[model samples]
Target: MIKQGLLVRAAVPACVLTGGAVAGGVSPIAWATGLVFGLALVLLTGWGLQRTGRGEFGPADWITFARATLVGCAAELIADGGHPHAWLVGLIAVALLLDGVDGQVARRTGTSSEFGARFDMEVDAFLILLMCVQVAETAGLWVLAIGLMRYAFVAASWAMPWLTAPLYPSMARKTVAAVQGVVLVVAVAGILPVLWTVAAVVLALASLVWSFGRDVVWLARTRVPAARPSAIVAITRRRAAPHHGPTWPAHNQAA
Candidate 1:
């Protein structure tokens, strides 16, 4: 059980600073600024609301939250027109690397909870969105499909309630999620030309579309009128059990 107070308290200051970071800018890149600050605020507030009760916040959450902060910073840098540097790449690479650490910390230390699971997933989704903004700078908006896929799925769920159903564990889904960050990071770091970056993002988007599509079709076929979430669901507030899988945030179980 997660107590609501902890996250809200800890996140308020960082969020305020992040807001000022957005407002103080002379001319922040529109897409970049909105993507970074918007996602950061959503993550902080959404996850804060999900956390409740009297559970220990745990080491894993701290690590994951730190990574999320770094992602917000990366987005801010892009908004300010700071070209990508080895240091920025390194920072994001660290965030990606630390993704695995949170899950492990939760499982081994027996600190896993629904809140932790959602926290991890939100961080992953937001970070992907931020990186997508950078990749789009060179690879075109087509590349954004990869980062936006998760959010798009969530939005569709609002209209199609069956899409909110918990999905079965799939290694393919986890692999696809992890690969998106690496490919986009590579593209953003200027490791690939625009052609390769767009091509790679397209492939990744296709895989994501396929994975989510399959899940949707399955949900449609097996829709249980009773078990369905509200039509207007809290997309990030999934009550999933924690899983120690290759995916940074894996598992599907109601709180």
Candidate 2:
């Protein structure tokens, strides 16, 4: 089952690369990069499935895999440096549109799992990062922050373990994240005036900052310190103690 699932997943990248070659005359560099990205994505995903003890890809995972393929194509386009704006924008737009679909499918199908959720999130993050790269060419390098913030927060968690706590779901956070992709895609499409594109990206970044800050503060407030070894031992001992209280009431005893 796993083998078949992986083969199916592998085909996505193959099709994407072939389509790019025929449609736009993919440069050697772009073709090579796309192949590497596709191979790495397949290998890593296979490793993850093995590590997680999953036998086959779930329905939602397939959706996320498709989205990831689109990102890979976008990366190839970025590498080629002569991609049509319409093609790039179309790929990203479809990917973004399918973003919410995977979650809904997972929920309805009862296949939701940590791996699936993480896979979905990683795809979203990478897409945003790629879009940021595209937008930065015109919007200024400050645009990269919108993509790098999540990774920065993740790195901070290694030093401050409290930041690793699971965050409560907030619609505001989801909204902020969704906005980043939409805004970046718009900026990439170059439909808006330069000033307006800059303004929209600025607003997106601001919202992202606010969302991350709010979560960090909440984490700090609710942070619980890890128990010391001695304290843990004491707790174990107390719980291990046997009850020795009398079973009879005082009146019955007197009688």
Candidate 3:
């Protein structure tokens, strides 16, 4: 949760700095001035925000928050717009280092929450999109498609309600998603050109496809049958449980 707050706050300033640097034409003097200012803001504000409040704040929260702020800055730096190459790469590496640590902080501190999970997830997503946009400028428009792949699945959930059902998380999948950003970042940094970038994009897309396919199959098989429960299971029931929850449950039951 602290990490999420850190990223959400950092994103705004990162975007602003990126724009300012680009608009100001990437002068060495301007870059140095902006770099110092950005670093100061990220450290002071991010650290302060993470350490705020008497009850919610803790060492772990501060640590994770610190990690996220550093990484988020790196992500913004590498994300096109004439950000310095060494600083951009350095920040990204720092972000990845903190990524592993933040969750440990949350777990050790016992401060993990849905808020934190969602916050981290969105931060990661936005970072991917940012990297995709920067990479696409060089790789090809098809590379941009990778950025929207997650959104495509998210939107499809509206049409196929069952698609929204959660599946048990896997570390392998998480690893794939995490590395996807790194691949694109490196690809755009010209460590690898269009050829390698395309391959990375393809593999990333395939990973998402596999994940969705498994979940869809699970939903199809495990979804409750559209009938009353067996007589034995129904013996102690007050009423049949709704097939869905809230919005879907109310509507499906009414229908």
Candidate number of the best lDDT? 2
Q: Per-residue lDDT tens digits of candidate 1, residues 1-255?
A: 344645553565367436535543635463456455655555564556445553445777777667766666676666666543675587689889898899999899998877778878988897888788877877778777778888998899899886766665568779888778778788778888777777888887888888877777656754634364452143223324354643222222221
Number of colliding residue pairs in each model: 5, 0, 1
For 57-126, candidate 2 gives per-residue lDDT tens digits of: 8999999998998888888887777768999898889999999899999999999987898899999998
What TM-score quantifies how close candidate 3 is to the native fold? 0.60
In candidate 1, the residue pairs with backbone N, CA or C atoms under 3 Å apart (3 or more residues apart, or in different chains) clash, namely: 2-52, 2-53, 3-52, 3-53, 4-52
Clashing pairs in 2: none
Measured with C-alpha atoms, the lDDT of residue 61 in candidate 3 is: 48
Please estimate how well model 3 matches the true structure, expressed as its whole-model Cα lDDT: 0.58
**Highest TM-score: which candidate?**
2
TM-scores for every predicted model = 0.73, 0.84, 0.60
Model 2: what TM-score? 0.84
Off by over 4 Å in 2: 21-24, 224-255
